[model samples]
Target: MARLGAGGMGEVFLARTASGRPLALKTVHRDLSREPGFAERFAREIRTNDRVRSPWTVSVVDFSPPDTAPQWLATEYVAAPSLADWVHRHGPLPEPAVRCLARELSAALVSVRAAGVVHRDIKPGNVLLGAERPYLIDFGIARAVRDPRRTRTGTVMGTPGYLAPEQATGAVAAAPADVFSLAAVLVYAATGRSPFVARGEEPDLPALLYRIVHDEPLLDGVPDALLPLVGECLAKNPEQRPTAEEVRARLETAGEQEWHRVVPPALVAAAGSREAELRGLLAAAQPPVYAPVAAPPAPLTPPVPPATAPGTPRPAEDLVAAPSRTRKAVLAALAVALVAFVIVMIVPFGGGDGDGDGDGDGKDGTAPAGTPAPSPSGQSPAVTSLPAAWVGTWTGLGPGTPDADGVARARTQDFAVTVTLHAGAVGDVMGAQVSNLKEIGTGRNLGCTEALELRQMRGNTAVLAAVTSHPTDRSAAIDCPRGNLYLVTMTEPDRLTLESEGAQSAGAPAFLTRGR
Candidate 1:
């Protein structure tokens, strides 16, 4: 027996079947096997995993409870190392490879969602970098869509660095949460460090989670096209994040063809036996049917034995000839009609519309002259208006300190400024400052800069970056820490907030309405 690895749950061993077929057999830990509910959950996982069919997902072969011996489950043995191992050997993955990894893993999540299963753990350790393609392993934490108990315990089941905000909060998560985890994994693959690393000694999981839930990620080197999708996936609110299918669709639209590589020989050989075992299990689950044989012809009268010695012979007049040509033609026509009826019954309808016009309207389906054009949501006609005045720099308060009374006091400082819009075009110094000043000031310097670069403005929000000081120490000496930068954006019309560690807010609208 070849030992693969051991964990808290169980020990995985490389084993061979009676026919010399290789397989990976995982036996449940002694302690877990003794638990009353472990068996049921394990059985459910096996059953659910069996239903999942994806090239990137591992296949389950056999599962046996500890009725007479130790409980064990067998899965396809992928020979490649985990993503974590690969990263350890080679520094960080290249940008293209990182994007490729993200696309593939996100597509895998799509499959898992289709199978009615959520892979709660999507960290690097659970992802295998096979020779041909990546595979998602360890469905140990996989729960069916309807598993209430899985959420009730609120167990921190996934890796700390890769968990979504909702997962960290012990909230019930859907497929989007997996996407969030995948985004984090991609970030880690791009950069050697996790995106949410703390400055001090050890990173605080709760604080990191709070940041993930409330703030945008610090994506400095990530590609622009991929960053937006990653941001959507890592949205603080689960509802705001896109679905797995949406992620796959967008990635495909972005031209992600030829991403799947050939499977390595070792992995292919290992997966083959496991797949065969799964087929056997399915075959065994179904019962076989035998067609009835026609009864033997009835015996003729006994008196016929005198003439034929064994059977009586029918008269030549009793024999009937086959149908006539006209009759055969009519029968053929009836058969054809029956086939056409069956096809109509089985084939779906309304599949395609010419030129992809879903409503089946003509190419020029427009309103007549003098008629009002229909607006989205069928509301009042939209009015084109000028940009608002509050599109420039606006500041509020800053973080405060505790008073002598120890009642959690804060200072009423007016150091906060929110830039709604940048003035000029790209490469223009003034416009660059106004556009990216907040991001540079906040992310680069912890919000210590007097003036920063304005990266871009969206609606009422602006992303800014801090400018480098002539002498780093000189800026620090002047009480303006070089690294004290921030990224501030308007949450809505009412509130202007900073994305610094100490988020400051002012002019918060009492009833701020969301814009499209």
Candidate 2:
């Protein structure tokens, strides 16, 4: 196990299960865990976590019982860089990717609202740029919206500059506050500067709060396409801002193609390489030892199928018969082989039902698939639906349209999309698209890849969250606007139709055929 980092309440470690799948194990500080009412608070957070079921957020795998010493919580570890880290190293994201980020984050907020929760923090640091999609992480400060026990008067939570005006003013964050912060984040992604602060300037906390309440966001560098929405989000009146659902609806024009335009190739390569490296390490790591079980005594090794060789007795048969050095060697070999297989194939990193890799049943004391895994407080996991019959590649084309500027000088381009579905649960899809048209003036080609996750299914139609985009042809790919949802329907045995839900210019569903 590797120590990832530490936080105010606990220390986080990257540990592999007996099966070698990686997980983020967060152990609460012993002093904090023993404090009065801390157990109830921790348990409540676990219950709150179970209610938020979005493809954009990480899921809890298992946790220690609340009453136990050294209480801990385990969640699926996302092998991706945070939005804050990426922007700081690579600079601000292009307009298209920022738009995509907006849509994805809005969808996350939608799920949070559905669960009657409000994420008090929605800054870039909390967003992980996964290979397929962005994941919202670290929900430590989230609170129930309707719960009467809200923040104490005069107490404010959230980061400076990114906080909504009301949140900075000591008001309890609501769904709309999340929207406000979402816009602020978009501003930073587009300009590498906070909406309320000038470039290269870091004001004191109180001063930043005053500006949030009194000043208009500095949107000088934001794209024209996103200017209005970002301005509206920064509005002093929280009621004036769009709801998370509405924000998602408004960004429908920013489809998978737009996402491909803004992501840097270096970022994409790094994410993929990091994931491969982690898997390699897992395969090489030794199995973790376990303490002796009480009384009945657990099996010395994991179970394996009977051997198929003719006239060869199974390991179980040998165990029942006698104690021989040769038999013991054979049993030990089988045990070692079984452990490797589980690590290499059966168990996946971040054990959860949504990963679309395995059935999350807690066979070896791990949490069951799809539900909240048991927390330290003894909370059981919940059950959710998995994807069925939507696990294949589908391709289609959108008719050529004028460039984003809508100027007469802009060139028209047709967009082609290849949507690949995996057999996990929702939000387990990848898509790549290329433009038939060249750059407005230059003859260079354009293309990009995006991460999509299943949102819901209505009969033969699957609604997916367009999580994030990655650029394939960095120079030629142009930034596109944001849209959060896509509806795909199996029109025939070999045909599918995809439409961006709530897109104003969405004319007709694009017809797609099964791809090789």
Candidate 3:
């Protein structure tokens, strides 16, 4: 069982099928089952509900009345928490998600109306959030357009915040009644508060109903694009409201802009940074280390300008340095010319002896006295390869459960490859497999260990074999897929290159490089 909730009519439990498919089962309250006419109404509602077939409508799978105990109805269980639960914890939803909810629920009502049914109740409690979608629930209160049960005297239905004016007045409702309820639900999702507020000692419910029928909603904070649509939904005359299909189209168009407008720039920057970091980490073949470099000395500050009354003579040191500068320039030029002459003299013998000697001496090519050797260009040493100790299996980030063996088994069955790593290896296994492997596990075989066999190791490339170990495993020769395995080779301490085949195959050679 995954979830449990209740409506005015019954309790709902969400469970999974044998194949792990989810389902929602609703059981009528024992007291309600015993009430006269409840069974007939429930059965009729179920029949009407079974006809709805919109993406937004909750699908009915099975339903049964009490033969010996409480009656129950089963539906396709959506795989997400409810909107009410989401609101309680996350406060109001973003404007886009709220608009999406409103549009989808309205479309669902249109489908129900096409089936000649009216969902007398449309509230947050009855909406289930599915991953990437929404599901409308609690159709047991639905009634056919001409159903006489809707005329029942002194019976008020629907939650206080969502009930339409006609619903409160006992007037037979059409599709617009649900539209009004949908608007209320949207208001709740958008603002975390209902449009109609209950005030004073004995809140005047009649005045609130009157306002809903005649007045415009106080639209603070509501998106301008959605305000007009919401106003149409809350129209006093049922004929004035647009059909659910129109609302769906309008909201879908509005949602794209709202989503873009609300996403924070910081989140976008963080995503970009993470992608860059991951790519760098995955491609690096060698471990990285940092060494501090010496800082350059600051330049000498220039002398400040001297204060002068009209036209004063400069200081003696500044005046004396003028001739000294010309003399120093002449001396520097002479030194450069001497250096050029020496280089020209040595050029006949290939600039210098191969053994670094500048003199013409034959004995070990020694340099002349008082000559200093030039320093080699300064550069950090390159990382050539990963540490030998790092060659072993490693785990990835996810829920830690079912043990390593269990995860391996599941992967072998679904993905057709046994996934393994060396003790400290960073990526998936390489090489040939003895048998096909699965990517996901079933109940009985929840193992996660992968056996990797080291095949060959070249300068920057290593070949490995991925072997599957299962009682029912079968072996076969398969073509290598491109980009399947990456050989990460470290050329220097800070440089790692990834080499792989450009295209992936079931079995293919992979390559890596230190640079483009």
Candidate 4:
């Protein structure tokens, strides 16, 4: 068994399946399982993770059935190292590499939001550097996009230095919180120090939080182009931040071949060497000796059948080689980020359930497929009753929309969206400079105008069954399959919701209200 490292929740191990397929298995510490209400909380977290499916975000593969208690969760293993490992080994990244990292990380957030997930942990240790693309790993603390009331106040979660000012101050960590964390990670990548790091002094958690809430970042070393945008992300006001899509649009001009050669030769050689060792481990006559730790005994050899494979992504070498916790940079054994301040293990499902996520693929960026339809309070009515409140301009910043906080928090870009519904059909536009989402080309404040007919309405649910032509909009993908089948449900008289129907879900149900 190739033991990769440990995290706040459990130990990550590299193991093989019966097919010899590689997987990364994180076994929950036995102590946590004994806690009251842990079983229910664990099950809910799995469901939330299952909703996220993106090439950029690491995918969680389930080996346990619905009824059985899962001892572990497995994810696709990539051969790479944490962003921290690479930066520490190779020094700060060049402008081109940083630009590439920003773009890819933004794109990854695009998917993460699409699946209604806000990864609370966006630190360097959670980011994996692949052969070409950078992947967002460790969705252990991800929360679904929903009504904000569900968040626990003063949770005091996540990494100390990476925590956004709002998060540090015990405010709700919506999408903007993630944006702030990602920006901090970028600063570290570009300058070898967190933007909040005080010069000539050891980093202090409380002092850092105070500075984050009240001070401006010292980023003299950052490129002129990225300075303001990243600063905006680190803004104390969450509403002031831009979305991930917007960031991607701004950086889109950086270049298409940006991802190439982002890695230093030394790290690449190290990765190759680790891969060779992993391959050899598959056939070793005897497994390596277990180096015991003060905590629970390290597994003699990781239990097989459904373990995370090594030489897999985030190669065992991917983690910094510190004995206690390899996965993260600062604390390896206690994997949770909070700098040992406060770590909460339970996965809290946000708020009230709404309409179903139309399909399992998550492409249309809808809700989870099995969201409990409104019951009384939530139940869809048997009669085909349409409320007049549906007519009006509904606007909110969400995935694919500029100024979308979800994109901002995910360390991605933003595209604002506005839709006008006139009882029968709806006209909508998202983004700027580049308005046509079907065939995306980033631009500032550009509007993509398209029409979707509300073909059916039942109870509080309304389905946009077909797309209509907008002859003036050149941004539309003329030849592509672009008719929108996304669902829009009205949970309340004044509230409007939009969700995807395909495999790739877009940043949760885009909750909107009339006129802003």
Model 1: residue 72 alpha-carbon error in angstroms: 1.6
Least accurate stretch of 10 residues (summed lDDT) in model 3?
341-350
Q: Higher TM-score: candidate 2 or 4?
A: 2
- For 1-516, candidate 2 gives per-residue lDDT tens digits of 344544444455566643345776666556666677777676556645645667898766556653576666677777777776678778988777877888777788888887677777777667777777777765643331112212334755666778898888888777788889889888988898789899988786677788999988899889888899888888899889988888888877734553334577776777776677567556544443221111111211221223344554555445433433434454344333222111111111122111122212223222222222111211112113333445577777765444343331234466566777766554455443322444445555444455776665433445666576545566554544233456565655567766553222211225888787
lDDT, candidate 4, 1-516, per-residue tens: 444544445445565432234556655544555566665556556656656667777666543333343245666666666777667657788877787788788888777777677777687767777665778876644331111222234555566677788877767678777888888888888887778875455555567667878988878778787888898888888889888777767767734554657656665666665555546544431212212111211211212211145433443332323231422332232223111111112221221011122212223212122223211111122233334566677776645533323322222234455667664332332111112222133332223345665544544455563354342355433322244354565655556666533222233225776674
* Tens-digit lDDT string for candidate 3 (7-106): 3344454433222234555555566667677776666566566656677776665556235346666666544445565555567777666666666666
What's model 3's lDDT at 158?
A: 58
> Could you tell me every candidate's TM-score relative to the true structure?
0.47, 0.56, 0.45, 0.53
Q: Report model 2's TM-score to 2 decimal places.
A: 0.56
Q: Which residue runs does candidate 4 get wrong by more than 4 Å?
A: 63-70, 142-153, 254-256, 283-516
Q: Which stretches of candidate 2 lie over 4 Å from their true place?
A: 140-153, 254-261, 294-516
Better of 1 and 3 by lDDT: 1
Q: Judged by lDDT against the true structure, how good is candidate 2?
A: 0.59
Measured over all alpha carbons after superposition, the RMSD of each candidate to the real structure, in angstroms, is 30.0, 18.9, 30.4, 19.6
Tell me how far candidate 4 lies from the true structure as C-alpha RMSD in angstroms.
19.6
List residue ranges in candidate 3 displaced over 4 A.
Answer: 1-7, 65-68, 142-153, 198-216, 252-516
Model 3 residue 109 distance off true place after TM-score fit, in angstroms: 3.3
Full-model lDDT for every candidate: 0.48, 0.59, 0.46, 0.54
Instruction: List, in order, the clash count of every candidate structure.
Output: 43, 17, 53, 70
Evaluate model 4: give its lDDT: 0.54
